[model samples]
Target chain A: MGPATQRVAGPAGPPPEPKGAIMALTQASGTRTEPRRPSRKGTLTALLFLAPFFVLFFAFTVFPVLYSCYLSLFKDKAAGLGLGAVQKVFVGGENYLRALTDPAYTSSFGNIAVYCLIYIPVMIVLSLSIALLLDSAAAKARGFFRLAFYLPNIVPGLIAAVIWLYLYTPEISPIVDAVKASGGTWDLSSTLAAYFSISNITVWMHTGYNVILFYAALQAVPKEVLEAATVDGAGPFRTAVAIKARMIAGAVSVATLFTVVGAMQLFAEPLLLKTKATAITSTWTPNMFIYDAAFDKHDFGYAAASALTFAVLIGVMSWAVTKLGSKADQ
Target chain B: MRKIRKTHVVVAVAGALSAALLAGCSSGTAPAAQSTRSGPVEITFSSWLKGSKQVVEAFNASHPDIKVTFKEVASSKDNYPALTNQVKAGNAPDVVTVEYPHVSEMATQGVLQDISKPAGDFVKSKFDPAAQSLVTFGGATWGVPLDAGVLEFFYREDLFTKYGIEVPKTWAEYEAAAAKVATADPAVRLGSTVVGDSALMAALSWQNGAKWGGVDGDSWKIDVNSQASMDAMKVHQDLFDKKLVWADDDPVLQKKQAAGQMLSVISGAWYGAALRSSFPDQAGKWRVAPLPAPTSAPATAFYGGSTFGISKNSTKADAGVKFIEWMTTDPAAISARIGGTSSTFPINTEANAAAAKTFDKAFFGGQDIYANAAAGLKTVPSGWTWTPGTPTTFSKLADGGAQVKAGKATLSQILDQAQDATVADLKNRGISIK
Candidate 1:
């Protein structure tokens, strides 16, 4: 059992030393002998575990990113009327500076930021609240409810966008009919409507996964702590706020971090929604602009540079969230 | 002891999981390269052709020496990036579909091979000069023109008969027809309403004697606010305000246009398939007619058609050109594609000869729809460039138009906004548009 069990546990799983013993001893004595160093054999085994990830990370993520950084420095040169002696010439940060100042690019970023403001907190609260409800319920069908809540997350984001787009469209949408029958002309093509429309799609598609994550974290909170809170006359709401809430902050932080990163890569929803939201441009999001630059404009070098810069921006943002979230948790 | 064993099992399983996933990904891409290696000089061709699967299939079957595998690229918006990236990675397809708008940029990038000399026979007599002109970037023919999709006005013949309205021959007559149609049915629209400064409006403007780019051809000047185009826009705005057309661009608009809800639709020759598919009940009630002539001239305009170019990086350039020539010029192949696909008109004269005999005029109330299409095909004037910056520039114009429509801004302000945006977009792409 010891050998087989250790093998099944991930290479980065907890060490053999008892966690409780180590914590207690460290607190009391304030010092302890170091555990045995991982052997060369163990290091080799660890590399075996790591090799797969590094290969893919290098091939797909690292290479393209580095290549994009290299591409950003040049503009494809055409000799005359864009028809002759073609070559690539280094233009040195020209693409970057232009992208930064471009009205379309700036506006797209602004629209997405506004969309994130509406989306992130609402998604977190609703997802966490539903997860808590499922966790606290005494019904035996809790598993079924869990599955039901998480069902929408299984739908691919593109498919979800397409479905919502159809529903938002005025002519054939049943939703549109309802709006019209009630003496309301709900046009999702309007600026505000487009914002809400895209946000609603993100919430619908992702709320379920967030619920599952929160539920898993909620289940990990010790029953004894909750029982003690109950014995102390702390009601469900009080228990949730003071005790259960703090216990699930880890999951909440993780979910929030991911949502922020994902909001930056907003493409498929806006691209599909363009068919419905005539007001919504194909380059309404940053990723969509990158798409336009590469495909529509045929400026691959500039597009590649923008993508690399975007990747860096996302990395910084993700790190900021993780750092801020961890600080908030503390 | 049990805990330690359990942890080890978890570690092993996790390791195995990653190993399995890595293996899966590597194996998936490996086959793509391997299969092409063993094929009969495999020439990979890509197209954003959702409806031309039969043509692709015919090409694959009829040509055994140069096997052409057609990969359906879902959207034109995403296709070029994938193509350019593949080219950068030294894995470009042997031949790729380059839409008219991107032909200049692609040829400018030196990524498309020169098929000018080889494709001369196919280009000169077989295809229309205007259609051939689309693929001729940098004075060398880079691709074979596949279709000539001229924008024509399609209307409901039954609706015209039912309401006692004649087919419009002039812009004023078109306006009158729209008004009459609107008066007859509250639910019905005068014609399709356009959202944004789309290519359709540009075509209408061209028909109205406005050039999007400057006439000098060296500098940028938007004719977006040119009197003629502005007049066309004003007409659109009036129709939209009158509730004669839906002021949206949703798929539901296609459904509405298919039904009798729309009296007319201004679309390319390929719209016949859409009308048939969406409203089979109204199939025998539709008819094709020339675009209502503008005051300047009695003329029609072309809309959308993609061209096929051999990638400059392709190792099998000769084989790829052979496949393109075969696909574009073969009488049997084009006829099969046009008849099977059901709306696409072959650009080649030889192919048109084959396709003309096989038309289902029953779909258009026994009218010679192809002849109507062919008549307008001659009127398709060239010099309509679909610049790579067009999407970016026009989108900004659309955004500005949205603001103007909402009364948040003036049309003049929107025009200024669009001009600045278009110039900036061109500059960003490193194209010197003054």
Candidate 2:
């Protein structure tokens, strides 16, 4: 994975690994922790297992991405509906500049900025509250409630967005009709309003998965520590927040990192809502904007340029998030 | 030791799975385009047209040598992008429908083959001159003119009569009627803009002599937010501000049209057919007229139409041309297309008249709606070409319009940004935008 990553910029390479080479070396040495170095035969066996993974990994993920990076550097020059042979010119940083200045590309990033602002903290808080409730003695039918909460997560992102789009639409949605009947508005007309409407779908679809993770982390907390806190006359709420939440800080930080990454790649929900919400253009997210450039616009060079620049942006963001998350762990 | 062995086995299994996937992916070879020893050579027609299969069936019933099949690219919104991808991948359908806005873009991007050698003479002598001008870019013929989506005024006869409004022949009169009708009834609307369709705005601007995008000498000229466009936008802004036209750009605007609450629309001839199907209850209440012009000049705009072309990757270019030749000029092909569920105004002059003959009077209260369309066809403004970045340009324009609807930006401000953005976008694509 490390070699494959070096070959192409991975959009997500593991948030905790500050420098991949150091991480790999430490792991290799620490795993066989002994006075003697690991045998050559042991290394050969590991290589045999890793070789196939590297081949597939490089062929699919690394090659296409690196090729995209390569393609971004060149420009296709042809004349008159391009009748003659295509002339390829290498214009090193020009495509990157074009993407940076492009209103369509830049505006899509703004849409993500709005999405991340509202979705992340709200989702984390909701999932944590639900997980604590389920872990507490007050909650009955724990298994059934957990299953019901986790059910929406199992639905594919595309299907879930489609289901929610129908529900968001005023003419079809009974919820929307009921709201309107009671003189309340569920307006998906304006851009900011539409963002909220679309953001609600992300929250509904993903909150359950986080709930399950938080619950699992709670289950792993030491029974003795929990009993000690309870025996000392700590109330359920205090024990849940102060003890259980603190114990699962590792899981919570990991979950937060993933949520930050997922929020940035938002495309399908807003894309499905395009017809229902007119403000949501095809270029509504960075990923969808890149998809249009490559496929719809057939400006592969421009699309590739945007993809590489986006990768760098994501890397920077993940780095910042990891730093912030790790400091809080202390 | 047991744990380490199990973990090693898991990694080994994962490695095997990925290796197998890689092998499976690389196994399939590219299909050879030409026939080896075939009785009938089949070609694919990729389009967004609804009932395209009927035309292919009619073509096959006559020409047994070259058979064509239909493959839908995407919905109208994503059709060009889908087509662009297929062409780039080298397996694009031989007979693909290139819409007017994408005609120049596709050609310049090298998706289309130069049809000048095979069907150039046939296209020039048979198709309308205006349609010819659109397909021929960079001094070479590129496509077979399938249809012309000439814009016309479709209004409700009963509403106009009830409001004491005569059929408007000029923009000033049209505005007056819209104001009068809206004032007469609070629930009623004059019309609605196609919120998702930038072509509708471009079509109106075309009528007002806005050279939104075109080729001149060797350089491309794209004037999306020019003074003429401002003139067109100004009129629409007036209508919208005064509540003369409903600001509802929803697909649900069809609901208003069905109920006869919306009085009129200035859309392509295809939109009239849509009324026949989508709003059958409004039958015998609607009528057609020439598009209201700014001056006394008889000018209309082109909105939605497809131009059939052979893909550059097709091995059977000769057979492809033969199919296109029949599809464009032949009477049988024209009738099948005109009768289809989502057909447009026929591009062939004679076909236009012939299709007009087949118009059902029951739908339009015995009004010859196609007759108005036929007359308007003569006035569809020409010399307006498209750029490769047209889809991006349209998206920007529509987004800006959405912003205006949200009251975040003024019409002039948004449009000025759109024009400059379009020039930059085209230039960045290595296109000559001067």
Model 2: colliding residue pairs: A81-B107, A81-B108, A296-B81
Compared with the true structure, what per-residue lDDT tens digits does model 1 show for residues B1-434? 75566567757876786677677545523423433655477768787765456776887777776667777888886677787666665667888887665666576555677788777566766777667556754456777787766778888877788888998888778778778878888777767666454567667766666556542354434445667666656666666566666655646666676666877888888777767777778867788889888653658776677778887667676777787777776787766666644676777777676777765667788887678888888877666555435555566666766665555665445655666666665564455564
> What TM-score, computed on C-alpha atoms, does each candidate reach?
0.82, 0.85
Global lDDT scores for all candidate models: 0.71, 0.77
Off by over 4 Å in 2: A1-55, A79-84, A100-110, A170-172, A175-191, A274-284, A315-330, B1-33, B36-38, B194-196, B338-343, B357-359
What is the RMSD of candidate 2? 6.7
True contacts kept of 1: 0.36
lDDT of 2 by residue, A19-106 (tens): 8889799889878866566765577678777876887688788988888989999888765334456678898988899899988799
- C-alpha DockQ of every model: 0.22, 0.21
Off by over 4 Å in 1: A1-53, A135-140, A216-258, A328-330, B1-44, B48-69, B75-78, B120-122, B125-129, B213-228, B315-326, B393-420, B432-434
Chain B, TM-score, each prediction?
A: 0.82, 0.90
**Per-candidate RMSD, Å:** 7.3, 6.7
